[model samples]
Target: SLDLANGPSLEGIAILNIPSIYGGTNLWGDNPSQKKRRKAQKTKKDKDREFSNSSMSSAELAIAVQNVGDSMIEVVGLENIFHVGQVYAGLRASGKRLAQCSQVVIRTRKRV
Candidate 1:
C-alpha cells in the first residue's frame, strides 16, 4: 500500500513500457496463451548475433532511460518535457550507446 498524497492506492497490472528489439522474429514472442509459455527463438547462445547485439542495445537504452527518469525526479518535479538533444546529452554524459536504439516512443499518462 502506497501512502501517497493524492488518493487511495489501488492495485493494477501493466506491462511497463520497456523497449525491446523485434528483429526478424515475430513480435510478442511465441506466447500462444496466458497460461502456456515457450522459449524465444533467439536465445543468447543462438546463432543470431544481430539479435543479440540489438538486445544489448535495447538493454542499455532502458538503463539510460531509468537514469534520466531519476534525474527528472530530482531536477524537475511534477512535469518535464525533454527534447531528443537533451536525452542524447544525458545518455552521452552517462556513457551510454544509442547506436542501435533507433526507435523511440513517448507516452505520458497522469491522473488528475
Candidate 2:
C-alpha cells in the first residue's frame, strides 16, 4: 500500500505496485518454454484453445491484484497506496519495455 495519507507516517517501508505479471519459472506447473513445447506437440485444435486462453483478461488481472493486495495487507499491515491504471501505462511512462525486463538472474559456479 502507498496511500498518501499514511505514506508520510510510515518510516521505512517501501511499497511497490505492479501490473499484470506472467511468464516465469512456475513451481506449480511447466514454465513458459515447456508450455510452448507442449503446445507444439499438441493438435491444431488444442493449440488454438491454448492460445485462446493464454492471456489474462482485464477482470482476471484485477482479481489477481486484489488477491495479492489482500494477502500483503494481512501479512504486513496496510500502508500508503498508489493506484496506477495499468501495467503498460506505468511501463510506458518509465520508458521500459517488458521484453527487456528481467526479474531475477542466477549464476552457477564451477567446481574449484
Candidate 3:
C-alpha cells in the first residue's frame, strides 16, 4: 500500500503495514547526472562499500515496510519518473524473492 500524501488523518484510509514510496516528480532537488558522475568516480572498494551501506536486504526490507508502512511517503513531481521506476523495481524484486522462497518452503514441506 503506497501513498502519495502524508498525514495522520489518513491513518484509517491507509494500511500502515505497507510502506509508502514517494518522490517529487518536479526534480527540483534531484541531480541524477551528478550522482552518476560521483558514482563513476568511486573506486571498486568505494562502490562496494556504498552499495553495502545503501542496499536493503530482504529482512531489512520487511522490517522497513513494517515499521514505516503507511508513514513512508515520497513527494516527487511528474518529471521524477526515475524515482517511481526504482520503487517499482524494488517492489517487483521483493515480490519475486518472496514468491521464490515460498515455493521452496512448500516443496520442502511436501517432501517431508
Candidate 4:
C-alpha cells in the first residue's frame, strides 16, 4: 500500500526483480578477433585490479515491474516515484543499456 498524497520517504527500501541487459556474445556479436582484441587490451594485473575494484564496489539495486496499465513502471533504489519503462533508457543514456527487456516484475523490502 502506498500513499501518494503526502511526500514519500523511501529511504532504506529495497527493490527487487528489475530487468537488466547482459553483455554476451549474443548482444556484442561473435568474433574471435574481438575476443582477442579484448584480451589484448588488458594485462593480467589490470584484469586483477578491475576484478578487485568491482568486488569492492557497492551492488546496484535491482528493480522489477509488470505492465500494470499503459506504462511499464520501475522501482529504483529507495525512490518512491517510479519511471515508466524509462529506467533502461535512462541507464542507456548514462552508458549502460539493459538489452532485450521483454517484461519486468518488482519487489520491495526494508533495510534492517
Task: Score every model by TM-score.
Answer: 0.16, 0.15, 0.17, 0.19
Tell me the spans in candidate 4 whose CA falls farther than 4 Å from its real position.
1-33, 36-87, 90-111
Q: After aligning candidate 1 to the native by TM-score, how far in Å is the CA of 106 from where it should be? A: 0.9
Q: How many backbone clashes are present in model 4?
A: 8
In candidate 2, list every pair of residues with a backbone clash. 1-80, 2-80, 2-81, 3-80, 3-81
lDDT of 3 by residue, 1-112 (tens): 2221321121112112223433322211222354554554452223222112333332333222222334442222232344445445553221211100111111222555
Model 2 lDDT per residue over 4-109, tens place: 2322232222222332232321111112354554554453333222111333222222122212343331111122232122222342222111111112232335
Indicate which candidate wins on TM-score.
Answer: 4
lDDT of 2: 0.25
Superposed Cα deviation of residue 100, candidate 3 (Å): 26
lDDT of 1 by residue, 9-111 (tens): 2232112222222222111122233222122222222443222333333323222232223322111111112322333334322112222223334333575
lDDT of 1: 0.25
Worst 10 contiguous positions by lDDT, candidate 1: 71-80
What lDDT score belongs to each candidate, Candidate 1 first? 0.25, 0.25, 0.27, 0.28
Of 2 and 4, the candidate ranking higher by TM-score: 4
